[model samples]
Target: MKIDAHQHFWALARGDYGWLTPELPPLYRDFLPADLAPVLRVNGVEGTVLVQAAPTIAETEFMLGLADDNPFILGVVGWVDFEAPDAIGQITRLATHPKFVGLRPMIQDISDVDWMLSKTHTPIFRAMATSELAFDALVLPKHLPNLQELVRDHPDLSIVIDHAAKPEIAAGQFNEWAANMVSLAQNTSVAVKLSGLVTEAAKDWTVSQLRPYVEHLLDHFGPTRMIWGSDWPVCTLACAYDDWCAATDQILKDLNETDRDAILGGNAARIYRIKGAA
Candidate 1:
């Protein structure tokens, strides 16, 4: 069951993607599953985990609706009012839907790095903990410690750190990001998305430029804890879907078949809890 564990969906007119800019024109418009499925077929990916790129609960519901209709969408990581009084109720309700696998808050949008670390967010964290869903931290390097603490409180919950903490690979700031990643990976239960690297590199970066980050993640998380993601149209800012698929292939070409299988799909199937009859 080959899976891309971290992907996105959005409508441009919704004005939801805060990161979408004219500079990121490629991803500024609609990127529905219809636009991406062909690319998945070309890449030999069977199903995907639709991650949150929208900024509101309405967007989460909308994506959930899409997932309900789309069989290829095996799992969804939707957003919610993490601080809402009904936080637990909402997650409990959403969890009944098989595709609703996890939840995410746009932690990167908050100016204060510790916003999610506050006591205010504990109920929401605990609710997700009770439901046994992942809290996909869409955060930056600075927020890892806070995320680490969140994991500590909810030991039963899984934390999938998106995009290797969205590292600044283009600027080539490797050491600090590498250290933070190593520290986070030390948490046995935390997993990582081996996606979104193109956005961190030069638009036309060669495979060599991405080697160190990929190597570090593979070295830290190993094949058992890391999964691949397309980051899709967002990836278009740096490379196309085919380009990313090709790069991922080359980056892991040296691995044994089993390790390669784990990075590509085995770990994703296990982490996202996708049950494929094969």
Candidate 2:
């Protein structure tokens, strides 16, 4: 089954999306399942992993509500206050829902790079491990070292690096990101998402420009550990939905069918442990 492993839905009326403003006209409007269903059907995408666009627990409830109504959404990756006193309690309560697959702490937005390794939040990570939840790390290259440490320390915690650590492809900045990614791949068993690359590239980016990074990911992580994601409306800023999918298809044309299928959907299902993946 083809799965758009990372996509988001948000309603501006909710007021929880602090970063989404009217200046970004393309994504200012509400994006729900109905808006995405037609394209998914056209592309033969069977399922999706609905991710959080806001940091509030209330938004998590909103996502859960959407999951309740949409069967195509295989799982919901919501957000949580990592340093909050009731963090574990929030995790426990969210884990009760079968669709609540995991939580993302929005590490990229935070000013502190070493926040993920905080001693104060150790128990929260443990609680997540106890609940058997995945950790979607939304971080930049600078945080890769600290991320590597966390991945090594918490082997039980299923950590998936979101957007391949969001490498800066637009500005031709690759050496440091590539070196860090190599380190993570060599040292930790962390899974990296092949999503959000388009957004990180130039506005007029070509598949050729993105191919090198894609190749690096494949070379290091291989197919079984790599997952494809659309990054959806955000990706629209750089490339259309179908164009990104096409670019991915072209990039993976050389890989065998089994390996291609794994990158497209199988790996996501396995990494997130989505129920009824087939």
Count of clashing residue pairs in every prediction: 0, 0
Question: Candidate 1: misplaced stretches above 4 Å?
Answer: 18-23
- Cα lDDT, all candidates: 0.84, 0.91
Which tens-of-lDDT digit does each residue in 1-278 have in candidate 1? 67888888888787777787778666667889888888898888998899888767788888889988888888889988876788788889988877888888888888989888788878887878777788888999888877777777777778888988988877888898888788778866789999988887886789999999999998988888888988876788777889888889999999999999888888877877765513
Task: Give me the overall lDDT of model 1.
Answer: 0.84
For residue 134, model 1's alpha carbon misses the true position, in angstroms, by: 0.9
- How many collisions between residues are there in candidate 1? 0
List residue ranges in candidate 2 displaced over 4 A.
none
What is the Å distance of residue 173 in model 2 from its true position? 1.0
Writing each residue's lDDT as its tens digit, candidate 2 over 1-278 gives 89999999998899999999889999999999999999899888999999999999999999999999999999999988987889999999999999899899999999988899999988988999999888999999899999989988888888899999999999899889998889888856689999999999988899899999999999999899999999998999988899989999999999999999999999888888899996
Best by TM-score: 2
Residue range with the least summed lDDT across 10 consecutive positions in model 2: 181-190
**Candidate 2 structure lDDT:** 0.91
